[model samples]
Target: MGGGIQWQQNPALCNIMQEPWEEPDIPDVEAPTPRRALTCLSDEDSQKIYDSVPRTEDVFNLHRGDLELHEKLGAGNFGSVMKGVFRRGGQLIPVAVKTLKQDELPNAESELMKEARLMANLQHRNIVRMIGVCRSDMIMLVLELAPLGPLNKYLKRACGRELTMNKVIEIMFQVAEGMAYLESKNFVHRDLAARNVLLVNEQFAKISDFGMSKALGLGNEYYKAESAGKWPLKWYAPECIYYFKFDSKSDVWSYGVTLWEATSYGAKPYRGLKGCQILELIENNRRLERPDQCPPGVFDIMLRCWRHDKNDRPSFRDIVELLRKFRSKS
Candidate 1:
């Protein structure tokens, strides 16, 4: 009557309806636990991650107390290089201690370590050597002392009266040799200039300041910088200025400017010209004129280095060979 199914009032139907429905048994199984995603790591966790990687053997750590800093040799915005004595193995050896200012330490430690690591791997008479590193209260790079100081300042102090054509050629040859070694190691000295080169004496020159240097990866011919800043525009090649590309060829271009500096007795390249004017000059295929003291043959080398086409530039190896012949003739 109510539109529902009715059971028959029979014995079998009534017995079946009177009985309750039974549920089938199901096996109980546990659900898998969810993994927590790590959005940030704690200091301890970060240290643990790096602890798995092996340390580089090139870094030789030294005790900070062992170094006695004396006179400040030079100072810059980030740090200073001071004359120091390093006591090791019962020997007191004179060294240059490079330290970052307290105010700049937060942002400059990585760069200082990078410079130390690069210098440690390099072993050449014409390349500055890293004695060791100190990471105690502050980061310090102990380096072999170049008593004569920067080549640019040394040249300016000499002022042409002390340096002869032969001496200048010899200095250039030594720098070329250092650059050749760097090239063989696949290292590019992005800041190759007279100011970056240091001298142990008038006859011996070593390339220093690897903060801007880069080691090219295997099979890579060039490195691309991520950002533009206060770069040495006058010493840079066209490709470097435009595309931020750097390679051995760019170093050659800087070397040409450095040669000009040496021949001109530390005269600034593109003097009095602003960065934009220098860029315009380069875009128009114009270059610095030859210095009065620079020989025609040496100036020819500079021209070859400043070729508009990077591929047309000579390799450090070729320049070294050419300089060798020139030195012999001089």
Candidate 2:
């Protein structure tokens, strides 16, 4: 449902640093465990499954013959996404198939498989659903088709009809809600952006593309770029850009840029500025101005998300609450 990915890199581990919210006064609440796939296996086998691609019993092991590949949807560094239909139980189900490029490094293939495993655990209404996996010479992930495709493209096309403020709020609100769910599970969507958000039936927004997402842990908050991976510079928080550090708070910073995209009706963030130039502007404390049609309340939330100090950024839970308030007012 989304596309235009660049260079990829495996996450690098870093030194442990306590999060601001994980204070001494407040006990650290245990992160939520992802719903495990139904599988009957020994502990040793389960450990092996956890280490590699775990078989999801609930999800189908889609055979190649069952899938009818149609038009190409989009392409990324790892591979391409295609529109396809899965024949199951005498029913045809529309699906999106994300294939791993055969030419990519073996590590890339493994990473994509791991991403599928992660997606299998994540089952939320606002998040794209992974229906199954096809593991042959070529690996493919079967996902629910987002009829309207990417949010950015959808917004651009919305010129035919007014992209109302309430709609924008609702779209961003869905993203925030999905992100809040991820945060609760200690998953950091390192690549959160408007382009990564997809729309189902042009009404329901769903977060997609978890290839760049990471499960946060001690000494894992900051991902040191192993190679020269292409990051979303404009959407990155200062800490993420300058130090390669990322967490839920950094995700909030990206969410702010996404809000800007929504408000500007899919216009590029830091338009006309190079990545380095955008970094310089951000370093100088320059932030995106509120869109002409943006509400003051919404703009205020964006400002809070873009706080220079990551600790100063509002939690996704807080952001969700603020969005609900705005929606209620509307």
Candidate 3:
């Protein structure tokens, strides 16, 4: 206590000790905002997302009242094709309307929409053009009318009237050209039978019914069906019959069968054989023989298309070239 009293008596030492310490002030800084979490999609989820979006290609959406339904042209498992008039831009245009049967709507809508979308994108002289689509209480695809109707029916009628060989060849040549276009676009028309070919006039043929066409670009040379249905066993290739695999090569094989139908004047392929029998025949390395009056060169082309090994089958381009040469020779 006596020593501490000595420091209080010293003025300079007391002033230093009694001074209070001062601290510097700091400005506040804001914290950064947190980011939201991201989600990874599975393949199936990605496909569903893709399917929900509309294609960039122009597709007309129409109202139900715009179309006036007329006589039915044909009927199929999914729907009916009828001759109709579409009121467009103050003018009535004749069109073929494909209407979904109400009872099948729940199960068939996706397929119908897919077909409509595909047809809308395709624009070729030898491919049917979709005009517009009406998605009201039911789905209706308005398409350009092919006045002469399907090739199979036309062939039958022409046969009865004794049509010329050159005329028949001309029709098939157009089909080959259409197929070549499809090949160039990487589209595989799984159903390439005569019934699916439509005629704009008596001489011109267009490939239609793209419900089974598959666009290839995803490292797949073929499409394997996920489920079974009423497949055209007569027009299918050996591989298609056995493995359910379809590709441009399979369509070529079907084209050969369609040629058979044409040259034979719409005669049934494998006329007396059952579907199972036809499969067995093809499995045993047998193919449809030449039609009674088919030109040897034309039949040769058919043989090339019906090759047991799909790799051995000629491309549609080759088929078109050969057909042109054949036509020149004729």
Candidate 4:
């Protein structure tokens, strides 16, 4: 009454003369739907997994004196690996025993099973063999013992300050030869880091650990993406980083990195750089160079492996031929 009779109401200000206005309404918007949840493993699935593993009821129980544990050879995510002694011809024969941790992923168990299967089938002078495996509630692998352990580790302690040219050349040449044979069998070592290559004796370089291995086949494309991503950053190739596609060419890149590590006398490769920084360097045309002991010819091979394009890298066969030639000339 006061506004209408005595005062003028300003539109910019609150209009006292007007009745209280109802709030303007808005239509409700719903939140987005979330992705479907992953399916849990059923009892049947677990049973099937249990049934698929390798069992060794024929062998004596680990508690018995049939085989005695000697020393821990290595340790990994699953369990501690130890050297064992089994009596044969009144002498103790050495073997490697890898015990599995129950906490590991289902796929890790599957990978171990695959490794056992592959080792059972392969009988090569340069490849490590499976003596036996147990599939009880706890899993274990009895393998042909590598008394010398990883070559790089052995080389590090032996060649404390530096590496001789002959040693580097000899190791690389043997690696190339083993790789060539594996390639011929249509097998690609998905993980070929220095650790995977073991020494039977101080002189024998045997390719061990087939968990990350690929058998030649074409119908398995659906699983390739899931299967291939697990890689050691220090040894991965540009192709593996860029596109997740690793073939024999990817192995070549690892070989080059291995050579770098060997030539360095166990110095780490690209220690200062993070994974992203490493990718940046590679994209910008940078690669890890050979260590001081690397011969000029081996250095050339390292450079060749650093090619940005995967197809441009040399094959294992080519590596063997080149190494042979280099050895002959030297």
Look at candidate 2 and give me any clashing residue pairs.
none
Ranking by lDDT: 1, 2, 3, 4
Superior by TM-score: candidate 3 or candidate 4 = 3
Each candidate structure's count of clashing pairs: 0, 0, 0, 0
For each candidate, what is the lDDT? 0.74, 0.73, 0.72, 0.62
TM-score of each: 0.80, 0.80, 0.79, 0.74
How well is each residue in 1-330 modelled by candidate 4, as lDDT tens digits? 122222123331123113222112212432222112211333233223223333353532333345667767767545778877655336455677777765755566776777776667665556776656665666777776655567667566656443355655666787888887877777778677666677654345667777667686854421143532334666877555444566777888888888787777766677755555566677678888757766788789888877877779998889988777666433
Task: Indicate the residue-level lDDT of 185 in model 2.
Answer: 86
Candidate 2 residues 181-242, lDDT tens each?
A: 99888898888888889876444688999988767776565555454355556787767655
Rate residue 87 of model 1 by lDDT.
76
lDDT value, residue 208 of candidate 3: 86
Candidate 3 lDDT score relative to the true structure: 0.72
Give the runs in model 1 whose Cα sits over 4 Å from its true position: 1-59
Model 2 accuracy (lDDT, Cα) = 0.73
